[model samples]
Target chain A: MLKKMENNTGNFYIDVASIQKEKHANEICGDVFLTKKVSAEDRTIIVLSDGLGSGIKANILASVTASMAVNFTSMNAPLAHTAEIILSTLPVDRERKVGYSSFTIIDIEAGGTIHFVEYGNPEILYFRENETLELKKTPVTIKNRFRLKQPLFYSNCTGRRNDRIVVCSDGISQSGIGSRAYPFGWGIKNVNAYIRDEISRHPGISSFDLCRKLLANAIANDTFKAKDDITAGVVYLREARRLMVCSGPPYDENKDTMLARDLDRFAGTKIICGGTTANIIAREMHREICTNLSHTSFQLPPVSSMDNIDLITEGILTLGKAHRLLEEGFKPDLVSKDPAVMLCNHFLLHDEIVFVVGTKVNEAHQDPSLPVELEIRRNVIKKIARELEDNYLKTININYI
Target chain B: MTEITICSGTLCYIMGGADIFEIETKLSEMYNDKIRIKASTCLGFCEGENKQNPPCVMVGNELIPDATIEKIINHLKRLYTR
Candidate 1:
């Protein structure tokens, strides 16, 4: 259990999230991210770097800069030295006369002492319960032996449960720069007001969704064809969420008791997938399996229920169908209340996902009558793991038993 | 010419190692011109009443279960060498 300590304002847990958008049909996004320290119990470190240009070069530059930033922070290097190193090392665009990479670093210690540095990047907007808080920054000039000189803006603050910090690339702050919508760029003032309005309306949005919303609206301001690579990193301090999913069953019949006991022992919400797997757990627990013969998708099999299993589903069909739905972007309300959708919602809502995957293969999954796509069990689940990590930024632990 | 069908469907992919798909490159690299590896949507094995051992691979008319790199390569070597 996490002991709640009072920060300057209130006690809360830290949650950091980010999302990216490449300009137009470009394969490479110029924005690179560093979130290596978020899972640390006492500290949170997140950095977003935007390379000078777009595509491969930009990606490489941003990647190098973000990686170096994380490494330096880990080594506890001075911010001035770190800034000078980056400014000198990164190549400059000849015509633009600008360093190839710019980054924003947000570092928060336990008990919500927030420290951040912005270098040639958009200023981050801090909020406290739908009301905006203006940050006070000190400019530090960085110089190295190479005679390279660069300046970085540094700031510090205290945070509460409902505080949100949104930092983004110029793609967001300068969205629709020359567009007819505003005739001027989507400046900091405009972005600030928009976020305040959004917070007031939703109030309970997760940091991930808030970042996504900001990026989406920013891209929309650029008329879907973004003029730049848009990226937003959101750090939201709030309560914690945890979830556990049990999919498949062990091939060894002897371990059924172990699997059942594991599910029963799991403190978080438990989801059991696969009809046979659910039956195995039910039989092991000496509980009756109740069949729910309702319809989620007419083409897929119906759902089932048993005691202690938060969700019971028809193995591959539910997983495959859910993968397709989630692949299209997991929208909680849009998905019907089927086992798969319910399971997807469970995955989306929680911060931590514990996947207990049984190696047992269900004989029913190879049926020729079913769609070939439904026959995919491991691959789809594997895809789900990747998608959850990449898109939703959920921490997943796959326990293969 | 030999017809080697690899089941790309889910059950076989999972029950048998996902490496079953990698047989294509190995077969191609070895037999060069003699073997043709193709993906079958579903071979109707590992599910229903007609389920068979999987991950299933077909070497011409013979369907091999739990097809491994060594097992498939040995069979190919036997058939072509003979």
Candidate 2:
């Protein structure tokens, strides 16, 4: 998996989960996927299936369907046609088995264009910028051919960068938890709202953290000790690799001189600016800067802002606008070479410093109020930091400070 | 008098034959407040282990597996007619 991640391009990610529970002799319900990043071409293929029934049989059903779909798609089959073949070739229910699996396929190119094919209820949700969309089959399940024939056919669509795509099993929408034991499925309607809140809280979060938080919340809401299998995948897109450059606080008292000198130098690199730093830079430059609220350079006849200051505000707004511009089904990725960054004179900033009172002899001291064992906190924190370091070298910058 | 409780989670619902309300209606018509019917959440009986032998309903202390409308009706008739 690490090898695959290292070689993958275009910021593609996938998540898979299942449970063999004591509640059911056959935990047949869950999802299966055959995924790989085609590094050379920067295209990623993700084929997923939700098997019929529970336990081993259901697992086999979904596994066969996913394996076949991925194999065929890798041969370059078109998304819709590939889905049709998988649907048609199944057991066909001739022996009164009444078994079939839901399937979806997505092919994302290096340029961040997403092509999707979906059949059955497990849907593909797109959250671009912060707007979400669901590309799903009709709500009614396709148990028999009669149901499959109506306008209830599966759907296919394509989208572009700064857009996010989420694929989920029906289990997530159906799960229940909490005092009222409310269902936390987020369904199609609330998946976007949920993602937007998560992204806003933890802007640099990895895909794994997002998936874990969603499932954990679902479990907490469920009254049953055991829950149905839950799975959700998030893919964020951008027109170019987004570079968030954090400038350290200003080193000197000459604020205007520092801003004027530092702003132009960073601007010369052509990276757009945002946040408070962009505003400060614009005020110092004393000129109107160009920017777009839509974040899309393609909007209208292409309205560009007036000066460098306006341009920097436009850039900051552009990032916000980019997040705002996404509706459901959009996948965000670098669509162009325009990288967006924050402009600053190192820093006019916010910093927090906490005083520590600990047993210097122990290096860590136990809290009398905590019910946990003496060393549990230290051990748990160490284990989590180790895991974070192992999985996400990019996001987990483990500086002790 | 016989008491019946049915499971209401997603799988049991999918398995169908909940029919608790109809069973209650039938009992009220036949026994006139002599019998009681209730709906409950999952009894933790999932597929595979039950091997699709579910749609469970508890009648007193005895569990009726693969419960159907006919099964409940028969059980109630046998217990209450006496």
Provide the TM-score of chain A alone for each candidate, in the order shown: 0.70, 0.49
lDDT of 1 by residue, B1-82 (tens): 8877765444555555356556665664657778776654345566667667677888899888878777888888889888
lDDT of 2 by residue, A318-379 (tens): 23223223212122243431222121111001011111111111211233532222342223
The digit string of per-residue lDDT tens for model 2 on B4-81 reads 766443234335533443565455476656655655434445433443345677787677877877787788778876
CAPRI quality of model 2: incorrect
Fnat per model, in the order shown: 0.06, 0.00
Q: Which pairs clash in the backbone of model 1? A: A274-A315, A363-B47, A375-B10
lDDT at A209, model 2: 58
Give model 2's DockQ, 2 decimals. Answer: 0.01
**What is the C-alpha local distance difference test score of candidate 1?**
0.76
Could you tell me every candidate's TM-score relative to the true structure? 0.61, 0.42
